[model samples]
Target chain A: MGETFKANVIDHFNFWVAVVLMMIGLYAMITKNNLIKKLIGMSIFQTAIILFYVSAGVKDGATIPILEHHAAETEQVEAGEHVEGHPVANHEAHAINPDDYSNPLPHVLMLTAIVVGVATLGVALAVTQVIYKNYGTLEEDEILAKIKAAENDG
Target chain B: MIWQFDIIILIFLVITAVISLRVKDLLAASMVFGTYSFLICLLWAGMGAVDVAFTEATVGAGISAVILIATVYNTRRDSSD
Candidate 1:
């Protein structure tokens, strides 16, 4: 049991680190009073999740998702040799091994997530600025207090 | 992938995340968060996700940080907690 645990820790170090980062971000988001701080924490949390997905897609000895064009094949095509079709077609004839390239699905998904995170950040910051404009402060508690006072007055 | 490099970058990532959250200066924290993004970009490149790294470098570290700094400048610069 001890040996397996050690091996797992060594093998999945990235996952463990990602988990720690996620927790740190969560803590900041939950505890920080400043609106900007909470946004920063949200950014960290988003990045941590991206890290986890990218790490999951990693394969040992795998190159990037892009397929390498062999010089010989390109030369043949350049020499007016009638190529059957695109490079992927030729790869299919040769039986391309999926393991040779890192998984692209996770990367693509994370790309969308990153864009969404940035958009959310922008919108949240805009809202935060408007809040500061109205409340004269960015602290959550201060804003709450102001709202309470306004309610009592009303 | 080089495990040693991965370990180092991940450690830096966590440290930057914590520091960004802990810092009193909001601007400094935003800068630290940018650093965290760049580190994660490096991690992605090392993991053979070059395109993702490029996107992260341009969007996450560059555009996002710039907007964050802009927001910080427009608002308060210090954090109470």
Candidate 2:
């Protein structure tokens, strides 16, 4: 049982770390009363998720997704010889093996996610500013209290 | 799998996170949050996700922290709660 636990720990260490970070972020978001701090926690949570996804796409000793061309085929071209039908000269003619590269799909998807996160954060901060201007405090409880008091006055 | 380095970085990340949450000063929290984002960027880069790391560095560490600091500047820096 100990050996199995050790193996799992070794194999999935990144995931475990990511989860711990996520929990920390969740704790901050839930417990913090300050609006900006909550935003910080939200960013932390988003990044932890991005790390988890990026780590998931990793393979042992895998290179980047960029396709590589064989040097031998390129060498002949440098020798002042145009080799007809040479796959190296025509990048589209060569089919790359998917196994050679780290999975790029996650990176692509997370790119959009990161942009969206920034946009959301901007909007949230803008709203927080508005709240501060209206209520004169950024604390959730204080803002709620102000709203309730105003409602009673009306 | 280079687990040792990852463990060390993650430990620092958690420490920064906890510290950010515990600190009463909002500006200090924002700085600590930037450190957290940077650590995650390193973690992503180490895991072979250069593009994601780049995005994290630019968005999480750069823009988000800056915007938060600006907002903090515009409001109260201390939390009453």
Q: Against the true structure, whose TM-score is highest?
A: 1
TM-scores vs. true structure, each candidate: 0.89, 0.85
What residue runs in model 1 are displaced by over 4 Å at the alpha carbon? A1-6, A71-94
Compute the TM-score of each model's chain A versus the native chain A and list the values: 0.82, 0.79
Candidate 2 structure quality by residue, lDDT tens digits, A83-105: 45433555434445566678999
How much lDDT does each candidate structure score?
Answer: 0.89, 0.82
> Which tens-of-lDDT digit does each residue in A1-154 have in candidate 1?
9889878987799999988988888998999999999999888888888889999999999988886677446655544434554444453445457898899999999999999999999999999999999999999999999999999999
Candidate 2 regions with alpha-carbon error over 4 angstroms: A69-97
Over B1-81, each residue of candidate 2 has an lDDT whose tens digit, in order, gives 366888888889889988888889998888888888888888777776788888889888999889989999998799753
TM match of model 2 to true structure: 0.85
- Give the C-alpha miss distance for residue A100 in model 1, angstroms: 1.2
Residue A84 CA displacement from its true place in model 1, Å: 11
